[model samples]
Target: MGQSTTPVLDRVGFAMLSIIMISVLVTASSVFGTSSNPKGVSIPLQERGSPLAKDGVIIPEALARLAYWDAAKQHAKINNSGPPNNSSSLFRRHSAPLESKLDDILWVGEIEIGKPRQRFRVDFDTGSSDTWVFSSTCVAPICSSKNKYIASESSTSTLQVGEFKKDYFDGTEVSGPIYADTITVAGLSAEGQWFSPIDQVNNMEDYGRDGLMGLSFMSISQLKAPTFIGTLLSQKKISKHIFSMRLSSGSGSELFIGGINPSKYRGELTYVPLESQTMWIVKGSASANGRNGFNGNMVIDSGTWV
Candidate 1:
């Protein structure tokens, strides 16, 4: 797989300029033939850091917006769908910053788990559907540098013997046992949420964060468990089935679950219906200015680099 760096935003025009670098997620209805290509995998890679713009031509703000739609188109092509439909009326919104790091390609956020609430830094990935973390039981070198989740300490933690494994396009792999615990994000909490505690890792350096919190649907999860967001929605923790993010060039970024923050973007919020329940697939057409544009489906993947 080839690696490229670019900034992208969500369909609703969130101003977050994600600096993505690594492999792309290939969708089922690939423009290219299907042969089990690594790019065809649904999982998104944790990207390396890059500046919002190269040279001096593209302004960061303008490029960020354009990249957002471009990323959307990429998702459409991957999923083999159409362009994103405009969403201007859904207005209930809530927001939280993408915190804990600066000048990084991937956005990191803090989430609380267990009874006493052990905090962990997580990469909120929209491409894949599984939330895996480093466990205290892990003796791997990569696990040593980050906070590990201790299942025994949580009064609500439950152990399960099911195997969990996820492979990225870059050849990074994580595998371990599954556990159900309480997870809280942005003041929203879910009880008995299923997640994996990684005991083995390969190409751990490809990911800069401690763990991955996939925001995609449960259909893609190896554990076949509802994701944190899905759990929240099912339990009525969040009212809407939508989330928004704003990644900035500063010390932190913002993530809004259940709605959009009107103060973040200026224009009308474009709405796109999800083509598939597995990932956030949107309908939209894409092209370079004056060039012939192609129409297809794209995934709004926060885990993928542009």
Candidate 2:
């Protein structure tokens, strides 16, 4: 299907279901308090277990409902939206298997870089365009706690000129120099991939992951470098220049790098033409509870926490 200029409810609105809830978890530490400890562990999506089970036994119905209700309250409070009317049923339908003990989980995946493959857990964000990682050059306390990418250890790594700096709306920042190296994710590999090796960070005490892997376009990249996903498409590593995601509260989520899994969702998938190549901005109208609230452009940013 071709991308649509007008936003469809199923396409834009429903696509944000999981992200909205997850963003609350992401912003809690950064926006409301100090501390960068992420609540859940980062693991490959394929390895996750059921969210409703404990020791092979289904959790009590009452307990499960209570947990869902609590999560809904948190989601509504953080987003400043109305309380969920029927959160129990909503959770029952969407809740899947999860491997974490947290009430909600932020999806992260593993990727390999360099010749020997230094592994890193990254948040695959669609809001921005820049694949950056913590570097050995960093002496900051935050960088010291997470995995740092070392260029000298990689035979294929090459230094690049100039620095890369990204500032978030909430005051978080990462700055470092650029480098080219081989990066592999979800079985697809891109050679000579340009990325930033972070040297310093500010107001980033709550970020729990090693770095971010941008899934958006190159236009908005801090370095304006070709994106890893774009390289995969250009090299024909993936059949189409597209990907899909499935996120759930306290459940296992999936990210399709180059395609969609029809079984992951119900009904026909809707496509929207990207308003900008920078982020996944699309033309869409928004409403509150079926009542027209606003109409304009929408950025489907998985990385944005507010």
Top-lDDT candidate index: 2
For model 1, how does the per-residue alpha-carbon lDDT over 27-77 read when each residue is reduced to its tens digit?
111111011111111111223343333442434653454455454445444
List candidate 2 segments past 4 Å from native: 1-106
Worst 10 residues of 1 by lDDT: 27-36
Model-by-model lDDT, in order?
Answer: 0.57, 0.58
Task: State in Å the error of residue 203, model 2.
Answer: 1.5
The C-alpha stretches of model 1 lying farther than 4 A from their native spots are: 1-104
Across 254-305, the per-residue lDDT of candidate 2 in tens digits comes to 6666545544555543344554454555566756788997576655654532
